[model samples]
Target: MIAAPLREKKRYGWFDAALRALLEETDAALEAGVDVPEEPGGWWHQYVCPTHGTELRFDPREREATAFRCPHGCVLEGEAYRGAWLVFKHQERARTALSAAAMYAATGEAKYAEAANAILEAYASRYPRYPVHPDAQPWMLKGRAFHQALTEAIWATTILRAFLLLRDEGALQVDAAASDVFFAMVSSSMTEYRRILIEERDEPANNYTAWLNACLACYYAVRDDRDGMETLVSARGGLRHHLEIGVLPDQLEFEGSLYYHVFVLRAYFIAAEMAERLGFDATAWTGSAGQSFRGMLEALVGLAAPNGELPALHDGPYSRPPYAREIAEVFEIGYARYGDARFAPILREAYRRADGGCGGGTGSAERRGLEAVLYGEGDWPAAEPLREPSRLYASAGFAVLRHADNPLSLLADFGPHGGSHGHDDKLNVVLMHRNGFVLPERGMVPYGSELRRRWFARTPSHNAVSVGGRTQAPHTGVCLRFDAEARRSYAWLRSEGAYAGATLDRHLWVDRDVALDWFEVRLDLEETVDYWLHFAEPLNVGGGWTACTPDAAPGEDEAYGYVATSARWTAEEPFAAVAATCGGERVTASLLAVPGGELYRIASPGTSVDPSRPLDGLLYRARGRRATFVAAFAAGDAPIRLARGDEGSVLVAPAGGGGTAMRFRMTEHGLHRE
Candidate 1:
């Protein structure tokens, strides 16, 4: 029953492989004295399923006579179990094959060896060949197209491990016919994949499809096929383009959400592994796929809060957050490949941070919830999550603190740009550091017209200039042109004397600028000056939200609000309000209003209120009016300034006497004729 030995190694031995490594761990556990039933008539065992938490039974006694039964049918075997299939999938089969082989060699059990051969034979017979298509072809209805490619690659690599173990055990089953057929299938698949990818290599967005191409290279290299390796190496152009377009230092997703970023990084990491195995370094092609992997992990760490939850995005699962368990997996891979030990501490800290966190107690913890995984060890045994906090988002805020490299001087804006995964949020900045904690985008994940309005066109979702006091027309259920909300005519992140500048052009109507220097997060906004403003109104001598400020003690600047009013007039001018909502139930808001057919407006402070109104608390707007206002905040103790300066140095006080002044130029519309 011993499998045939196959392939030669370059620098690594068969024992160093992933499958072999896991097997070694299991073997060590067994040797540490977990009672194992002897071969042939070995006894079965029962335990709770690790994934579904259902009762499970497994018989290691019989090679082909093992049985497993669970009430949920979340057994380790069978096609009817999607949940089970996802858990102990093809990857597990590969690992199990090596483990069985190693156990057989150590115990000299015909049963273990037979078990190894059976698994190998079963996979070979089932897949036989890897598919070349990116997805299931139109006619291939029974199974997925990409599944065959990914699964077969797993089978081939693991079978190679099986053969290697068999050879070392001196139980070589060298069936020349079988070996040739397997090799031919792998080699032919590589050829087919390479040709298809090459023909469509011009398209950059189709980068994920290259994962199959990389796997194809691995299979070919295992067969010592050089031509196929060359083809695989040549197919990296499109992938490189995809990674670059995803993010830039200056222009980022408004909200610091990184859902799609994970998939892109994974694609590159898998390719790098393939490149390394084939005697080719992918650093040049990938421009440090390893570093990119590190960057992503670091970002995840930064994204984690003290309590271990990532910032809440529209759809959570598309991009998973990090904790000890995930960090361990990343570090293990990094340690194996790059020989970097720095990742060790990061992993250890992630575990420490996630061990004891508060949970929602809905017991939905294992539903692939990103928040659960962020602050706590989640369901993984190797983790130690932090103590759970009361609110998940607050916990998420704490989780992000764990990864803050520059907690004091850094800035993070919660702006989801381009509406990835149908989350329509832009210009919303969640700035951290010593100024104000500004939560740009308010709540309401799904309360709009269509899918487009729900995603890309909701007013509460964006932090940009609004006209007629409304969000731009909804995204028309399309990617490229979502009603052209914010054309982003020009945007640049520049280093000022002490801070940086974030400015944008929303066509001709608005010129929005955010200056981040020392001690303040200043926003200089110039709107069309024609629409109705709800919050701050009636242009005054100074930019002062007077009605809301005198009695309140500014605690922490976390969030803010902007609205236009048509119902009342403090000094005979329509107004818009900008209020800063802090963590300590103190809300400091200002009302700035522009009158009908007036270019200049007056500003007064809106009344400070309790934190009962969550930033997701309410949506208050005028019934019928057109206005634009912005809400920006930062972390730390710096002042949050919302000043309107003109061409001259005359600072007209909004409240007639004690308003702050801007040292720059200015312009004036009309006087406050109240």
Candidate 2:
């Protein structure tokens, strides 16, 4: 039997610090006690503030309170909110049981063991009686304790870890008969979980499958069932198959969402750690194409922004406080497993930005968590600052161009359409400064929100061109050329199927101070196309703009209907400028003239859930079978001039005509800059 590491005392300062933190949390849990709701939980996503369209707040400490409150002054009571409270209770019970079990192993405290046993026994007794969630979709695998099998898998994995720790410490030896009963019930539920995952939701290349596999691996390891383990590894949609197919060649999770990427990584990491404890070679396992967990870690490290947060591409939250803390814990585990030095900067930054700390020590060591206590090294790695260069992940379909000293960076998405969770915004781009996003992707909203389909997931929410006011069709984009130099980086991408019988091409050039964008579209039939740019901060458009509503508000049936305010401009000059202030820094964009193009300034919902908060946007519309547009963007007071050049080329130069001029042209080969 594998002995729990926390059972033995260690002389490491980091370990002690992390242990102190865990014990504090465990003490709090013990005081609060466990509350197992008699009714099963509903979909957590449904617990949204109906008025504000944001998640409702529930105080875990107030276990009996049923009226959920939103961050705004809205209060909601009833089935969905109450059911969501039950979900919270179930989650807290599982987490508290784990903390208690760890404390019992570390300190041999009977009180901790009793607390853990009480929660586990309560769950075991009630597991068979809870009905499958009523709100679950017909195609989805339902759960007894939670709404979906995915969430049930997550709960079971945590609970089993607690159970295994207690079992290994011989805490359960006192009453073997009761322990046996608990194991039989929980293990039977796990078997049903495995059956549903394998027989019903047979998605080999999905994050859901990874969680299902983790739960099954934990169960088999606890039972010491070698045959079951082997079967899980060898089955068609099992662990090995998921690992091989779900992780793309570029090492990103196939979903193309940074949040889901980390989510899937956490599940696999847990499974690998459990397998290693069972004396298996799972940690050393490699996929068919030689992909390994180490490669995936490297991919994450490569994708970290200068602030160490991953971009909220596709369907994920922007890396902020609580989420950043969770990401730090994941990085701590990765550093322990691989000893990679690149993770140090991200770990340090994440901890520094985390909302609260354990008050244990200064610097990175201050914010240690359970992972750090269990697996971290004694001496913390130096938090060396990163000076990343512009690069492209061809397989993953992302190109990042970083300006010197990290003042400006642009991420261009030109790869495969992320399955299901992907936004229909091909050739979408997100621009950022050292502080935050300039043109941001609204990432995603809760799955239960109508706005998720009506606005956030649509093409208008991103920085891309929409044809016929319709979202782009699901399609992969191809990078035509990518080049990085000492002062400039350039990329050209093409998508043929974003619209049927049409071709879309984009050229992006980033210099030390300015970015030039050229977008071209050719359709077999005449159609109206609109180029969109959304700003995180409010924007001011200049050059004789007048308030006016168009024939329709852009797209009445589409995401454009969310536009609450509008203004129009028919430029007298060949160029128009729009500017925004971010963190007291002025950023400006200069648009080159399009023949007969109509420019509109609009305000739309700023975030996925909050419609009351508005974001500024610029929409340039043209009606034709073919269209081309050029624009230049820069920080501060740089005057940028964009104009048509000789031989189908575009010219970007200083407005006063003194600075170095750059000429760009698209050829049959690729984009060329001179």
Candidate 3:
């Protein structure tokens, strides 16, 4: 069997950076000493500020101290904060142990080995005494070191990696008895985690199950247990089963979040690497539907924006892009495994974007962390900017339309309601322009926060239509038509069950500088319909508007309760415009006024988990059995005029009065443009 690359120290850019960081972290741990709490740690999600719903600030130097402070100068104490701090300590210990093991392997230092062994022995000695957490939900599998079995699996994987490095380096030979105890404890923990996964986790395809399988695979590899490995592979919800069912035909994760897609793929990569090091043919493994790791990597490559960021769809962190090192490491592994040239540009771009593209700085140090040290091949090919065209991932339920020359792109979600992590936002649209999100999708807050369910996941928080002030029911949407050309692109989608008795259809047209939208809803009964849109910048309405009382606001239930200040206007003419200035660029939207349409400009929560930074929102409401909304969005202040055209078609042209008018007709077959 080939030795793992992590066992050898290499001379490369990323390697040097990783080694430096590891040494600093290990030295810090050595100075601070190890601290294992008698009580189990709390759930990590509970570490957020209660008032703001943001994460509490944790300084590692103050790990021994108890008081935790939020970013806004609020201090929190008691069991929740203390328990959460303990969890952070455990995580730091696991990471330090791995770093010390690697440092010992590279430098043959006795001090590093001692530090690593101390952490392992401490955990092993206390493993049996730590009680299962009391706060676990009925559906959750309780853990000893952490609140959930999922976290235990994560913590154990790091510890096992550290142990494997020490064992392979022969450092464990000095303390044979302690080594045996550690091994036994880890083996027992793996067994319990596996049992929990098989019996308790009904969804083998979940991201949590992925981590559990990774832990089991790592342990089996360490023991050279072929039978154990086979059992895990063939189990009902094991690695292979997850690949077959959890990966969609489009090769994206079934959860519909890029974050989880990369997350689950990381677990699979870890398990496969372990299997390969153990002389197992894991690289050749594929799902029944030919779902290979290469396909998954290719899907990410295609979905990445020109700047190498992905759209934060569904329940994901809206503000955070893929870490420079994280994505660089992913593509490094991809290039090594598949030798795909397409992976090269992404790697180069990630590195270039790291720390403001500075050659030597903290950013560069971060970009050159553990993944790059272990997987990267030193030099990367030069990056050529991506000239990506529009794409449609049909099976995964997403469509992207891009302008040829600029960074303007539109993403439409008309796919399966992602299970539990999914939001009530089918047929929602997000617009990305000039390297920023103009029409943003407020991804989600922490699951522990009530705002996650109350505001972030509701239909009104997204750029979609809601019925009678209620969130849309979970439903899948289908793409009716998609056509792309050099000058124009068009897509239409239909959702029948987003509302119980209504069917929603949305059509979009994209050109060099503008996007046109036509949304129509047919209902069984007369009900109020609201077309919702949220902007990244404050919106300023022009022409025919007046102040209104708070009672005149849209719906007050569901997410609407969060809407603070509002203004209302009745459009007497056929056209109304609202505009916002973003990064010195003007973004304008022109709407075709309905007979009794009431337009509103309001301040609401933006794409941030923090409620303090609110964004501008536009709500267009009309009451009828059938409602239609037509609008045009552009980068500059060219207001668009809309009117009825020949044969019930819609006519749209720049209100500035120079461009030729375009006609759009929607039919059962598709949308036609002339």
Candidate 4:
């Protein structure tokens, strides 16, 4: 039998060792005397660029000291040099380096040209010496450190693009002195990235870090680094091994988090892209590169709410990126390559939803879908145009959009249970309508370490089952270990048309049932735990007063209980049971109900909200073993059973057998076979 590949034996020493040495030498030089001269009028800096930390010595005295060298020796002029390196200081720094270099070439000013050259030279000089940071040691476990890593990666990509721009535009008019350094920098950077992949492959603790490393490797591979490409592929294989070993594929059971799913898609997307670039023939992979691309895109599209946002869980310090922008690019690229445009609209909607790019309007689901297709319903072109909002975070949502044509709705969960950016939303499914959304994910926002840990990462922020009487594990105060079972979600279009909708079934455990409605939902979580479903939107009650139990306390971890209020009070039915409970140890199951004036009071939140939305319903909590509550709704004379359960208490509303509306709440012991 063949033995597993050994890490030490892998080959990259020839180039990697040299790169590390050069980078160290450059770092010392920059620390020693490399300084950006203080200009009188404009901003010149002796400070380091917080992101990549390239040294800068900018001098305004252009005539005598026509050039200022970074440690790597690429020279730069006064203002342009400042713009080239410091992105946080100015927006122009975000532009491609090639563009910045062009500005200098056009002016024929030695200082400006040198400023650009300095950036390239600095990188080049250390290129052969820069070692991979990941291989040095373990990264800090704190969320802030991980966050910093994320930022650095983003900044580095932009800098790389600038270099590409310079090279593409023929703006590197300097002698080999500068050119050699620039090439070395590129090579060194690639080698460092290779090291990251190697480490991730050897030991991947965090899926996000793994994916980020894979993305770096893909970038290098596309730049024609064969070693880098293979390393990433090998890392991917290692990740898969861990998953297969630690996780159950058939039924994904996550404690509560969506971070892993997001990163998994990211790794796949980058790997697929890089593979295609290397002429590996993406078709060999399951469903082809186009399929993989479309699968991820559609996944993002389907994950989005009607309002084009995701849920409150798993959201943190990282700003949400534009989903549509990425879908558009990937879909267009795949379409051009494979001649398939079926999922093109998936990309379009992602853009439209994320960036308001559909052109027609906002909040119109139909229009968004139509706009996406209409825009891309054109003939194939050699190369499509690229637009703004290309950030990776923004593109994260495109995973769903890319998977538009996939037969199954994918669901995954894995990641840390606590700490920053943790969302107690494990085993969640990115559901799909026959065509669009069902219970769309609420988009994330900037991370607030304190707030996130306190509330955002809690149980009520996701779609899952609550155990005992709480959303989290009683012992650990985190989520419990519950596996997903018999996962399946796929639908076909019917004559009812685009708005008719489709059915999705993401079964958990053995035979749990989860059903959805236009404005309300009914889930018989027999095999699961006490159900706790969260709505990103607030509930609107039209009648009685609102109320709840074990409600919000000062600074306590939000426990389970009932919190509800009346929507309307018309003399006949005045008091509203905001939320109520019946059976269990003190309070186990809790029910939260809302009335829509229609028959389905316990239905899922509707896709269409009034142009002017109303305040959402009160949150319900339970701490015991069982609970129940009944909400009333005017169903236009229809006697509808919103929901019913056997083990726990069931809320029941009777509108006088057809009296327009009815009322309900928990029964005696919590049995509601009625």
Candidate 5:
């Protein structure tokens, strides 16, 4: 069993051809290369910003490498971008170590082996002296290997993988003392990494937590530490213990961020690959939803937009996040083990559609040179996922409704307003029409931008109800019912803790006609309740809710709320209803007022008078004990109409009325019609 890694390598000998090709491409000509990289010990060597003509240098000999400054005036404005640079620095070293190992295997070049050994030695000697980051969360973690244990884990996983390669292949030639020192450096730092994982054991496995576990599993396997490797098994109650519990039953990560989903899934695949090499048994694990390996991949397929990009739910990319790219190449290892035809084709197609032409962009920590070498050659068979859409993560309280023909997906959020990465979008509704948004979540913004607070975390961006004009409280969302049928299906979600005494329930029925999309939202408030309908850029607006439209800028500066002298819907003025057309779809929204008429407050089409402002959603509001809004939206040239029954049921009719209509029966308990 100890020789399992050798057997595994021998099994994949076809990959050696690819590795040799990459070696020649890089000219791994040991005949002429001798000088080590000038700066070899610390993070990055030196970087110059092309935009500002500024430079930031790192000296491996200096203890205060983090205290360096920007010369020629290129001060980075945000730390997220800065953090990416730091990760990149580690990535460069990892790529180097991997390249050297692969090159040595292909060419039997002594220089390649020596170069890889020198870098590892440098890391081993300097690894212990690095101080723990002061601002790391959880308070107990102290990263002596790097500024944060997360970064330290990345560094360890990288060099250690190379170490295993060299040691197993007989490329490593070192004295006994040198070997002992290298082993000691790794043992000490890895202990700190393990401590962080043990401390945060009970929390859900977010990206970093999952990463730490997977990396350590690989570490123990490489070191041949039997007791340590056992710590990762489910029987021992370890981090990788139970896949069923950590990943929600729907197979989506709890955070709901596509990038994080990719981050964590990548960690699992990498670890599983390493475990296989070292003769570990983790490759066969499966979760309740499906297996975390294949099941989660299908879940991601369901959550994706028609174009294959996922919505940036939490701390995901501002534009559609690219975590799916992480799946294709990393999934190669999993496909070999499962041989599930369903997974390979879906993964390959997604990889084919990648904007980068593969999984990662150049110069990203996600891109490993060896990954390119190990990926399959041109003989991949074409395949597609054997699954359909609108998967529900019941345990996490979320659901998505999708139709392959319509390319329109409705994502309903009722899950944990997850952690810090989560937005305050419990029971929020996001409608996806191909690449366009009917109602969108506050997409991410640069962390340091003004829009970050104004758009990312606030209530106005989400399609939610504000009771008494206050945002909902921090409550996990609940999905009461979800049925995905051709035309008769509907979605229902409830938010009990969004307010102190108020409860908001939303139900949406998707008519197969694509022109009779109807919904009814009920807000039970103790004091005042204002139901909001935030639409994307509207093509046309015809309604009674336009009276609150501001004529100028300061009037719509978010501070001033317009008070109409005479209300239109409830008014002394006249009675009218709200209607709109967006991206060729017509939407009509109306509230089920008990006996009185509906009162509303709507922003002007150019409310801010600045067409540049992203705040274009309309707000139709009312103050009462209980208010229910019945609305319908559809895609086509016809206007959708609604009629309410005396018994409190509502009927929605689309143009061309070809026996395709939807109804909603309002009741004291809840909705009875669909």
Candidate 6:
């Protein structure tokens, strides 16, 4: 039986030569991008210009140029060159070399072999001299060619693959010294990364830790460092710690970002796959928390929408369907390794996404080449995509309520707002109907931007409870209960730290029986607070009072946060409820009478919006303390009706037999469930 690349004899290693041949034919081989003219020709690179960490395409019409320029005529300025783009270029050179070597192997062509040897020799000669990127972090390995350890580790895996590809083709045989130097560079990189990773073994880990372990695993395999592999495999709180803290029990990425989750998963997947390829057992290695590598991928497949988009949560932007070409190679490879029949249908969906250029690679020959072999796209028949069930991520403190039949879904975030990438939106709620937002979460801006600091990440920008005219305080949440039983889904999250002296309990109840969904927020406060509900657009109507949604309201400043810019209750609310057209949807909300309860139409606080533009928002001021606000909203154009009871509770019924009449009462003592 043919051994994996790492186990093969280095002296005569054309590892996976058949795959290389396929890649060469399709220009997806490691050396596929390398160009050699049939006749000696002038440098083709003369027509191209590189700038701003991006490549500019020339018109190719101009024969001669003073300096290379893109069609936009922009001169390229070199930034610190330690990014993924630069790393991709380096890999391009390596792949090009490997492709040429593969051609020589197949056809015994001397020129191809020489071309391949030249690339390896050039890199090996200069390998020791390429300085650490000026922008590299202090902890980054000084002599490593890549700026980031993660990038360096990735380079190690790909470069080694390139080396193995050409070893059997007599290229490495012709120059034993260069071959030793090339592997020496690999050894140096592995040693540095392993040292740094082990040094910081106890730090609260992130995706970086997962990647570090992956790199170490791959390195151990290549170097035949069994002891090193054992050290890593047995390292306490190393990869195990990352899994324990970073991934929830149900396989949710604890950081709450789909992008980062995928990023971390891919690295671990590569490592585990590499380990198995080297005849090691790593897949079943669960973390300290009993979390296995397989569990992460198991739950990830359902996250994609019907069109293959991972739902945008945390830092990932809301992508429309076919989200960036969903890559299913992980699943594809998973199926191959585990021989699990379930992955076949999902694999088909992933292949469909790859065909759309989101995954598998449209322009990358290396990625496309491997994908063709690894994915086995057509080997599996297509099946219906799996729909993610309504789940409450209790450990991570995120609650999602998705309906059985409709696209109406609500994401309630009570989780740790994740460090750096986190928002101050504790107990915040985002609702979607038919994939269109009924209540939208604040759109994300660039990380660490001034606007992000001041507004976008603030609690006021979210659908949350504000107390004492300040944002919600930092807090951890306990999901008291989560049940998706028969007709409805019920979840209650209690947060004691939301306010310094108050306890906040938010309940999301979805009753599919009556086709109604609503939120019940009860704050046991020591001080008076305000409930801020920001809508996507201006409202057109208010029951028991006049609703204002002018093109531009006078005296009201535009705001991105829910903080009131300028708001006044025009007249005493002698009526029980208010109804209005909230942006694209309709909403009718009535307060359960409290001693100090008062309601008014307000505007969202944002620096970006013009004051002349209408900002649709709602504010309910709980006069004294201990305020309970009950709000019911239907996703689409469902109007509402409210009738106040004789005592204080308001009976809420939608225009068409509102599913359930939810009652919430607030007294000086506390909230009373009616």
Q: What is the C-alpha lDDT profile of model 5 across 1-674, one tens digit per residue?
A: 11223223434544555455446533443322322222222222123333322234332222223343443445553343344345444555555665677667656777778877766766655544544555444543445444456656655676777787788778775444655565565556655555545454644353566666666766776667767666565433344553655577777776777656766777777666566665667646777456567777767666655434455566654331133345555555545555555455445434443334321232222212344344432233443333355677786566777655553457777888767777767777776665345665545543333444444455545666666655556678677777877655567777778777666777765544442223333444445554455655543444433253343212222312322212234433222334445445554443334344245444421111121333445454555677766555555545455666556666666545556545667564445556
Q: What is the lDDT of candidate 4?
A: 0.32
Go through the candidates in order and give each one's C-alpha lDDT: 0.33, 0.74, 0.74, 0.32, 0.53, 0.52
Worst 10 residues of 2 by lDDT: 356-365
lDDT by residue (253-350, candidate 1, tens digit) is 22234433443444455555555656766655523222245555555544433223333333222111222334444444444444543333444443
> Per-residue error at 318 for model 6, in Å?
4.4
**TM-scores of all candidate predictions against the true structure:** 0.46, 0.89, 0.89, 0.49, 0.71, 0.67
In the predicted model 3, the residue pairs found to clash are: none
Top-down lDDT ranking: 3, 2, 5, 6, 1, 4
lDDT of 2 by residue, 116-226 (tens): 888877777777677767787786667778888888888888888888888877775324455456555555665676666657765557677788888888888878877
Error of 4 at 634 (Å): 12
Q: What's the number of clashes in each of the models?
A: 101, 0, 0, 115, 4, 17
User: Which ranges in model 1 have alpha carbons more than 4 Å from their true place?
Assistant: 1-118, 129-194, 197-201, 235-260, 286-423, 431-674
RMSD to true structure for each model, in Å = 14.7, 3.9, 3.8, 16.0, 7.8, 9.1
Q: Candidate 6 residues 1-674, lDDT tens each?
A: 11233222223232254355444543443223233211111212122223221123322122222343443456543332113224445545554565555556545567666766666666666566665546555765443566565655655555554454556443564355765666666666655655665465544456666666776666666566777666666664344556776687867677776666766776667666556656667666676666765676666544443323344455643321122223454665565456655555444444443443321123221223334343332234344434456777666667776556544556677877676667667788765444234455644433323454565566666777666656655567777777675566666766777667677777776654222323343445455566666654556543355544432222221223324444435544433444444224454444434446656566653222111223466666664545666666544445444445667666656446646665545444333335
TM-score quality measure for candidate 2: 0.89
Looking at model 2, the pairs that clash are none
> Which tens-of-lDDT digit does each residue in 46-142 have in candidate 4?
2322222233443321222434464345555554344223323221222223233434333344443445556545444433343323321254221
RMSD of 4: 16.0
| Model 3: ten consecutive residues of lowest lDDT | 358-367
